[model samples]
Target chain A: MSPLLEVRGIGKRFGSVVALAEVSTQVSAGTVTCVLGDNGAGKSTLIKILSGAHRHDGGEYLIDGDPVRLSSPRAALDLGIATVYQDLAMVPLMPVWRNFFLGSEPTKGRGPLRRLDVAHAKEVTRRELLDMGIRLRDPEQPVGTLSGGERQSVAIARAVHFGARVLILDEPTSALGVKQAGVVLRYIVRARQRGLGVIFITHNPHHAYPVGDRFLVLKRGRSIGEYGKADITVEELTRLMAGGAELEQLGHELAGYGDVTALDGPVKSEDEQP
Target chain B: MTVGQDAGGPVPAARVRGMLARPEIGALIGALVVFVFFASLSEVFRSPAGIANWLDPASTLGIMAVAVAALMIGGEFDLSAGVMTGSTAIVTGLVATRLGWNIWLAIGVSLLFAVLVGFLNGYLVMRTGLPSFIITLGSFLMLQGLNLGVTKLLTGTVLIRGLADVPGYHSASMVFASTVSVFGGAFRVSVLWWIGLTLLAVYVLRRTSFGNWVFSVGGDVRAARNVGVPVVRTKITLFVTTAVAAWLVGTITILRLTSIQANSGIGQELIYIVAAVIGGCLLTGGYGSAAGATLGALIFGMVSQGIVYVGWDADWFKFFLGAMLLVAVLTNQFVRRYAEEAKR
Candidate 1:
């Protein structure tokens, strides 16, 4: 069968500036497609196009081999494409259950007597989180009290529960510490195991390597390469993401600065001390 | 799925954190402390008669404060809410006493007028994307001017009276100003309206989907919109609700006194906000309770009169209000800090 979602040779331009060009990637069921890019490398522009916030200027965006154009983010959502941005779109002061059911809250009764089904919402939130292996002591706790990793996990679980077939996460773990990021990475794998295709976007090659089934590297608004997991290693991916030969050229240029850094002592001792 | 892993993070002070997380607990405690302190100092202050006396004003202020708290929770403010009460009162008095209209119809006209002003305030705030503070401040100034200029133009004075001479005045007063006898203490009908409205506000805030939208919009507007919450409609509705509340207070006051001053509620807006903040509403929004606002109004009523009952100079009332506000804000800040420290 066709892949769940695919974009081939996608390109975009804002006025005379080329935001993205010749980017190709595909995501199939139960797989993770990691888009690796540095700042201003067309990552956000590509995400906007994929999430239907902006229309692509060229190439084909297909779902199940059916070429289509998404008119808006709502349209993408209706087609089972959900984008969980870094902010997570949550009310931190609200309880977990309330945030979980925020936009599409369940209700009981009718007319003037109608009210939120708080009991049902709490039960579902607890059940869904439990199903995802997140056991909270109380779902009534305000979301602000949740750890950063746990908050990301909540957003992921929310997306999955909302029937998202293709999940596009924008730097989901970037704000987190090392172990916290590991916690979020585990949730990405959890989403993959549930048979949803995930487009995981990040600049960190280490974050992308362990969980990624495929990698698409972008540099300066252009795709450097796209590869299967076996075709690339984390070190190579890192170098490529940082602009391979350009990194070497920059190292050569900064060689004098490196020598001056030796006088700072800690610049030379930074690696071993940490 | 991993089992028995981190499970989020540490929640060592669960019980304390849980209580503080309610936000209204501080207001509730403060109310109780003030009640006991005043009651201990003055026998009259604790008596049923004194309770009725203070509750009368609290009831009216409570009605308005609860509505203001809802708007505050929705992340906006209606500065005109205070003057809207006066404006609505003047409208009711003018129409009933001067237009030869029935008191009921006059009340209806005032309600409609208040709603329109509210809708305008909300619409401008939403359309311009300006801060509600500035927008509502403009409305407040305009309403103040209208209250004085219109009243003067119509009656050649800044006061509207003779509502007692209007048709249906008796019936209107019976509903709004009539007293209920309970344990030898007579409470105004507005007191019941206040209590009933408070309970309703609490139910709407905690048990309804619209209430969720209010909190969501207040907490973070962009985030709420991303999640599909109707931010504009929720905020507009909150503004309209506050206006309706002002209409209620205006109607109650006019019917009872049979007259209205152009500036009766001119500066009362700040007092309503004080009551709301003291009752647990965060000026920043996204956190508060309707019950807390009502209790906040109750504290205001008790203290304003309790000072007089306990033989203190009434000049200290404003000072007492300022002091209470600071104490409440500091207490709320502390509680909020503890509530969010659960997983830190």
Candidate 2:
């Protein structure tokens, strides 16, 4: 099947600074496309461009093989592109149902008497989260009370429920604990199972390796490489993510002071040269 | 994490506790305590007549407080709200008495004036991205000066009169300022207006998409915009709501008294905010209730009139307002903490 979203050599330049250049990726429905990069690697810029926050300065962006121009976030949303930033786009003091249906609340009645259908919102919010395998004590509870991982899950479920064809999550697990990261990763898998193309952006290869069907690496506003699950292993992904030979050199430099074996990293010593 | 393990969901007892943890719960308790204290101290304090007396002040203030609470929840302030009352009344009285316009027509003109001022405040706040405090404070002072200067200029004095003899004055007064007897105790029609306004506000805040937008914009404007909420429109509407409320209070005061001073509603902005805070509104915004603000105004009415009914010095009213505000905010803090407390 054709990819739900495909960007070919897309570029964005802010005056003299090239924020992103020659970045390309494909997001296929029912699969996870992990965009892995460190800080300043243009991961944010790429996501912004893909999500229509900023107009790409160069190259082609396609949806279902049709070339299109996205000028705003709302335009992107109408095209079935949803981006979940670290903030999760939730009001902390608002109840789960309120946050869930915000900006698009379901309403009943008519004219001046029209209002949000509270019961319907609450029911759907609960059912949707349950479908994502998360059980909240009360959907009426303010979303701020939910753990970071749970909030991410809610955002993902909302995106899926809202009919997103491609979901872009910006570092959904970076601020979470191991177990929490595990929880969000599970939700990401659930989203993929729901037949949505998910762009899971993160710096952690370990978090990306298990769920990501395709991996695209970014470094300094450029696409370093793209690989399928069969083409790259976790160790190779991790090594490339950590700047490969530079990290191998740092590991050897610090090797004498610590038990490097206890590091449990798969970074191979063979990657380093004398 | 420990709490989410229950597949059966939270127990009824815990659920009840959760309800009690709300900020409004604190205001409700404070209101009840004040009612009892005043009732015990003075025989007339709890009487139907006494209730009428207190409800009079509360009715107008409550209307303003509820609107201010909505604005507060939307994360802004209208310091000029009080002065707008005086300014609007001046506009109405000037048009009716001086220009010989009908009272109702004068009121319509005043409403337009209030709306324009409100739009200006909101527009300036949005366009300049300044704190509403600074923007509205500027408006507050400007309106204050305009109230005194324009009233003096138009009428050659600080007060407007003869409204009682103006065209449509009697009917306008009957609707806006007349008294209705409830079981032999006369109450200002504003009390019913206050109730109706509170009900409408609570419905809008709790059951409408606009209410959800209010919370979102107040909670985090950037996040709200990212999610496609119309942040600017929501905030501007809030300011306009407060201004319209000021118009209501202005109409009530002028029609009821048959005259209005240039200084009417002066220095009452802080009182409206005080009532909101006492009713469980956060100064920082995004969390408040209309019912809470109504109760806050109720407490204000009780204390301001309760002191006089019990033969206490009216000078203590300000002191009581400050004290109650402090207590209510502290109580709200504790209650909110309890509400969000995770269980093992």
Best by lDDT: 1
Worst 10 contiguous positions by lDDT, candidate 2 chain B: B1-10
Candidate 2 C-alpha lDDT tens digits along A244-271: 8989898887885477665534455445
Can you list each candidate's DockQ?
A: 0.47, 0.37
Candidate 2 docking classification: acceptable
- Interface root-mean-square deviation, each candidate: 3.9, 3.5
Chain B structural similarity (TM-score) per candidate: 0.96, 0.94
**Residue A194: error of model 1 in Å?**
0.9
lDDT of 2 by residue, B90-197 (tens): 999999999999999999999999999999999999999999999999999999999999888888999999899999999999889999888767899999999999
lDDT of 1 by residue, B1-344 (tens): 11234543344666667767776787789899999999999999888899998898899999999999999999998899999999999999988888899999999999999889999999999999999999999999998999999999999998899999999999999998899888878889999999999999999999999999999999888889999999999999999999999999999999888899999898889889999999899888888889999999999899988998999999998898899899989987877676454342
Local distance difference test values of all predictions, in order: 0.89, 0.89
- Global lDDT of model 1: 0.89
Docking class of 1: acceptable
